[model samples]
Target: MRDVSLLAGVSRMTVTRVFIRPDHVLPETRERVQRAVLELGYVPDRAAGSLATQRSGFVGLVLPTLSNGNFAAMVEGLTEALRTAGYELLIGYTSYSVAEEERQVHTVLSRRPEALVLAASAHSATMRRQVAQACIPVVEVAELPDDPIGHVIGFSNYAIGRAAGDFLAGLGHKRIAAIGASSDGERRDLRGEARLHGFTDALLAAKLPADMVRMEGDIPFSFTEGARIMARLLDEAAPPDAVFAVSDLAAVGVLMECRRRNIDVPHDMSLLGFGDFEIGQQMVPALSTIAVDFDDLGRRTGELVAELLQHDDPSGIARTDVGFTLIPRGTTRASVP
Candidate 1:
């Protein structure tokens, strides 16, 4: 800052004001300081500045995986929302592990973010304690938990699962099945598991056998695994006429596998998936699946955070349920009259 002031022919206070309160500084002076900063490649350290202001001006966001486009969209919306409030996002991915999430929380907290937002509500005991001790606002997004640590802004994953099951069943498909990750290791997708349970209950309610719901796959399920799982599903003695994938990526994989095996979709078999991903919409036969407004969810979460931070006394524990929608495209069949 001292060197920037020297280069801009201004006092250190003028340089500081240019970065902190540019509106208070003259336009020409602001331009000079900005030019000096650019030439020196200088970036202000919010963490250091927070020592005086007590405002870190950044929020920590924890995500499960970057591989999913839906998560990416959420992050994009969140960043944009935060930008207007003069806050930035410090992002981290946990690869669907509670332990990793705890580690990430610790690392992010070290930087002293004003708030923390988690994509998943489930956390390790240590992580919960740590977050509580930090005394910062916490926001849980993507999945609404029964007991949230702080504010909740997301749809019910279980309801999405149930909706998928009900959609397929309503189409007159009696033999139904679902594919998602098995809770085999410490790494898990709790949201996917919730969907599976919801789907199971929905099937049982309709008096359809829920035994075919196969929860066996890896975390962050992919297109390749979807195809492989679909192949195995077809080899069963009593194959299900309809299948629900935990992800749209997997559904596309299933469609590809069906084509390879000369199976006609919505005729010989019907497919459904969660997440209304772009590729699913662009497929030869558009995918049928559950859709959540993840981008909107992120934007809302960010807005909530900004609102909380701006006020000295925030309102009560807020809960916003954006809900889910079931979209039936070419991949799913409706019962004939």
Candidate 2:
């Protein structure tokens, strides 16, 4: 900064103002300072600036996994939004473990983030305490909580599942099966559970045969697990006419399994998935799914962060419901049998 200041024939404070508050500096001086900075290849030290301003200029984002396309898109959207506001995103993954998520929260918070975004609504007691004590604005994504510790930006997980059930049921499929991620006490599938609950509740409400809805799967939501559980279901005396998979990964797995066994999809069995993964859309039978606009969720989350930081008012916006959509594709059809 000193070297750039000297080259620009300006004081160190003027150089600082140019980088931190360019709008306050004269346009010609700003241009001169920028040229000096570029010539000297001088980079402003964020750590030093943070100490003086008491702002880290960073927003933390904690998500489950990078492998999930929906999460990736969310990250992209959030990054773009924050970049527009002169903030960077610090990202960490918890792998869906409550303890790990708690650890990640502490780790990210240690960097002194201005705000934080979490994908999971469920948290360990320690995690909750950490978030409360951090004193930073928090935004929970994925599902809106009944009692939010901070702000929330998401849709109803249960409602999406219920929509799935209604869509399948409306197609005249009496025998419907749901494949879900089995919860490990430590890494519970809260969203999956809610979705399954909604799906089952909708089925019951529709007067669908009690025996027609079969719940299965103790594995995580993955393509391999989808295949494994689907193969198991196929061995049963009476195979389901349609299956609702907790995720597109698992749904595609089921579709692959059907191909392996030469079981006709939709003709013999229909398939539906959640999350609307990209690959699902290009499959031989495009997957029907419960679609959450994750990119939009991320954008809204970033907007909330910007809003809180600029106003220093966490309560300015309490909740944002991005909502979800049920997309029916080729994989799901009106029951022909």
The candidate scoring highest on TM-score is 2
Runs of candidate 1 with Cα error greater than 4 angstroms are 6-10, 23-29, 45-47
Write down the lDDT of every candidate, Cα atoms only.
0.89, 0.86
TM-score of every model versus the real structure: 0.94, 0.95
Q: How would you encode candidate 1's per-residue C-alpha lDDT over 154-218 as one tens digit per residue? A: 98888988888888888888889999887657888889889999999999999999988887887
The residue ranges of model 2 lying beyond 4 angstroms of the native Cα positions read 209-220, 314-317, 335-337
Candidate 1 Cα deviation (angstroms), residue 90: 1.1
Residue lDDT tens for model 2, 1-337: 7799899999999999987888899999999999999999998899999899888889999987777899999999999999999899999988778888989999999999999999866788898898899998889998888878788889898898899888888888887888788766677677888888888998899988545443455535889888988888888898788999889999999999999999888788899999988899999889988898888889988988898888754445578788888888889876555
Predict model 2's lDDT versus the native: 0.86
- Displacement of the residue 17 alpha carbon in candidate 2, Å: 1.1
- What are the C-alpha RMSDs, in order, of all predicted structures? 1.9, 1.8
